[model samples]
Target: MPTDASNFSVTMVIRSILYTTQQASESPYNYVPTEWVCIFFLTAYSISTAIHMGQALRYKLWWMIPTVTFAGILEIFGWSCRLWSSQSPELLRPFEMQLFGTILAPTPLVAAYFIIFGRITIHFGPQFSRLTPNMYIIVFFSLDTICLTIQAVGSVFAAEAVNEYKSPTLGGNIMLGGISAQLFAIWVYLGLAAEFFLRRKYNAPFRRQVIKFGKGQRSMSKDVQCMIYALGFCTICIIIRSVYRTVELADGWSGTVISTESYFNWLDGGFVVVAMYTLNVIHPGIYLKSVDTSLPDEDKVNLSYVF
Candidate 1:
């Protein structure tokens, strides 16, 4: 019905339109999809940590269980909030989740450290160590409580002033500082605990002779090794998170750091969740009970060796 030239021109117009539309669809902004893989892994890790911590509680490892549970719950909420963010990047609700989650998660870690040292004193005679066990608990945990309180207050203030003063920056800094302090304390405490344990192990001839008689006594060494490894991993993870947060916050509210929420999700959610779940695997419920019974009452009460 139409001339050949007319038909050819019409076909060319249609093809051009289609090609333009396809190009727009393939633009970088449109093609860059959110990372759902990270979300799934974080979710799985958090759930598993929570379940394992719940099981740990049944064994009456009260100090260890509560801290692990608290950390796991915060992580679950954080990851869930992250999922919501991935679905609707414009809503901005997940910022609260990230804010509160990071602030609340580390409190339980500090508390766990306190419990470990406290229990150690109870197991080993407090007199065996240069410092009293109760003093160590009071000093370190008191500092930790103060740090947590400050960080919590900062978070609340930051949340109220969201996007105004970049409150999360200040709050996150306080939290990072608190966690850094906690990590430092852990290292110090670990050194002190280890020194005490080794001193007692080699110096106490009577106990050494007694422990050699029973094959089960080797379990004590294994338990101590497990605890050291778990605590070490926890410290490293917290330090990593703290460093990441500190750098992210250094640029303030207007920086690309806060705007790029996805980056935060990976560092905060991915690394922290994995580290926490690892700690669950070595929970005191499994190791402590098996080895604790082997120690004499005096050894058990020695606070230096308990953790």
Candidate 2:
């Protein structure tokens, strides 16, 4: 409900705005009435994202929530921009908003998961990892950051092309490069995670150490498993979204997939929204409360997670 006269007037102004463009230069063709859908996504994502932040503060899952929260907030902003695009497609601002915001949004989620993986390996025993636990954050996250910058700058270039009324192939290629790089990083991370999990599950070395130390140590705690599940679930969701974006961008701005609003909702918006909500419901803080103290005192990679 609109609160005041000014609000009502602004609403009317937005509704009245419409974009007119020729076929050759027009990038995003309006496929559906995106105004309401964008708003719905924005609202849902905000609640879940905010809840994650609140959960972190309440339960002291400090390292976990920041990146997810940031990602969620960014998605909300991106969708709001989508609404702006719905109202005025000819305007560069709205396209720019959704383009850059959505592209950069998941990078933080990647960071969150990358950080959690290090912590997870540390808790499980860093010796199980092929690369040191420290490298998890330093290597993968550095890639994520670099990939994010490339994607962001590329999106900016693509969005800004509306000013000249000419599409730029270079911008699209840069964005694709960024997306492909990020996807490559994710695949590498997944490979590392899989190898470590397999080694811990079956390898004779880690098994002998566990046996030498204690039998019960072989079975991970229920909470620890939940933490793994949450991280894995979120990561899979990011991977799904990244894959969709990669394919969509391959068609370039004028491609059928990029122009399709339903695809955006189903793939881009759906994946992240589901992930944030899923993680919120799973609640990492609940699973990881006692995890920090459980690390081996000698090789313990110290991470400040206040319980």
lDDT of all predictions, in order shown? 0.60, 0.77
Question: Would you estimate the TM-scores of all the predictions?
Answer: 0.69, 0.83
Tell me the lDDT of candidate 2: 0.77
Q: Model 2 — TM-score against the truth?
A: 0.83
| Per-prediction CA RMSD (Å) | 7.7, 7.8
Candidate 2: misplaced stretches above 4 Å? 1-27, 30-33, 204-218, 296-307
Off by over 4 Å in 1: 1-38, 117-130, 163-180, 190-220, 256-266, 297-307
Q: Kindly list the per-residue Cα lDDT of model 1 for residues 62-154, writing each as its tens digit.
A: 655567677777766766665665554444456555567765676676567566655554454343454566767777777777766766776
Worst 10-residue lDDT window, candidate 2: 204-213
lDDT of 2 at 73: 81
